[model samples]
Target: MHFCELGDPGELSPSQILIRTEFSGITNGTERHAMLGEFNWNHFPGRHGYQHVGIIEATGNEVEGFNTGERVFYGAYVGHRAWHIVDTENGPPLLITLPDGMDHPYCALFGVAGVGLRCVRRVRVRPAQKVWVVGQGLIGGFAAQAARAYGAHVTVTDIDENRLSLARSCGTHRVLDACDERVFEQLKEGGPYNIVIDGSGYKDLFFDIQEHALLARRGVIGALAVRGETTFDWSMLHQRELSVEVSCHFAVEDLTILRHFVREHIIHIKPVVSHRVSIDEAPDIYTILRDRPAELLGVIF
Candidate 1:
């Protein structure tokens, strides 16, 4: 990847805003996919990043509800730079204004948190339902918290012991290491889960859940991961009439609901930001995430 200087943004349109980056978030999963040529637009020297929080440097004459110097968070297809010219009319307003005392680093989690929230909502989890989130990365972690916040009995699983420990401390009902030989037995002790969310982005883990995990009759299995080709257990699903859904991305409405949750303190995001680094260290950060995932989590740039 290479960086080149660009001309200064000038002559904003009637409904445009110029933003100066304050803090940006690196989406480890998707960004990694971009870097490794797995993403659809995997061309080299490409821009990659979605989560960002910045101060408004200037606004066009037609801009409303936003003023210069105000802080806001945005999700753009490419937003790893120091400045951006955002047009309001060309797209729906996905920009969210930040409260005065909000933490900038936490704002970076908005995109992933919104995705998690959507996954939890898609399954229509009810209070007292057993919910299992099979991963503790940013998306899985947030999904688990959302389930618990909505009054479900939430369990979290991860192959990494540290991540599982962190999830337990962060208020998950139970935490399990998926690699344990007795993981299925442990899960059975609490009875079958009503909703099983796969956020590990590992296709093999999803198949394992289909083969080993128990689901109540007509129970839903949510796939919150980037999917790949895999062999599924047809007989088991047909016998149970189970519902399998794949949840990805987010809608504008999801962000609105997440903003309310943030305002009410229903989902505290401070703990999810496990690392912070400058944007200039992008290369080194990518290396760390690729080689040693356990050493990092949410990284704010």
Candidate 2:
């Protein structure tokens, strides 16, 4: 059952506004975790839990900075179908309207891209800083490219050979097998990096990397993980003075930065589509995503 449909959309009270989703892009990080119920229940029952890149089709008189037919990137819950009426008393602030040249599918992938871009922003990579990115899916690719645009030397690591090859073709300097038994040794050989970006959706992986991260000493460790409850060891970070930053959402400024980067060809924003399925096929695709999910970015409806 789609958790988003657990509520009524037609009942926006006198104080609420409504939004319509032209197309909702599923984020690999948060979507995967939520599908498994691996999230803090404290944040539930809010207007948003998933990241939806949608547009406002209608609104209450109280709503400002929005109008019908203006394409925008907004967030909402799981039931962001073709048309949705929401009570937008508290929603993510509208990021921006789609530029003239950018298309809808590209807009669909923007949420995932923004998450990665925010990761780079959090670590504060300087020009020419050496960076290492783990995971070579859409977010990983975007993070690696974003760091490079920030003037960092980037090396991308992933277990999938095809993804690694794609990252290499996309100008990644070094590619390492993250699944190898000597993965830490391989990373150490290239270590003393200024930053390490983790785009893997699993929180368990983050816990495992504590020793090898070297994050405390001379590098920044950034994550786009969908974490629930976990333990953090701050004492270990005291020695290396590493900065640990977790990025959740993209601010409006981040959207502007992404837009400028995409327009300037610095971000290389592209739809990482594996298949195109119709809205009618969404149920099957959801099952696919729920069962044998691969390194897929999304199935656009």
User: Highest lDDT: which candidate?
Assistant: 1
Q: What does the lDDT read for residue 96 in candidate 2?
A: 68
- Worst 10-residue lDDT window, candidate 2: 42-51
Q: What are the runs in model 1 whose C-alpha is more than 4 Å off?
A: none
**Listing every candidate in turn, what is its Cα RMSD in Å to the true structure after a full C-alpha superposition?**
1.9, 4.1
Give the alpha carbon lDDT tens digit for every residue of 142-248 in model 1.
89988988899998889988778779877899998888999888887865889988888776664666666578788898888776675677876887788888787
lDDT of 2 at 92: 43
Name the regions of candidate 2 deviating beyond 4 angstroms: 2-19, 42-67, 84-92, 180-186, 201-217, 227-236
**Total clashing residue pairs per candidate?**
0, 4
What TM-score would you give candidate 1 relative to the actual structure? 0.92
Q: After best superposition, candidate 2 residue 43: deviation in angstroms?
A: 10
lDDT of 2 at 91: 60
lDDT, candidate 1, equals 0.82
Question: Cα deviation in Å at residue 172, candidate 1?
Answer: 0.3
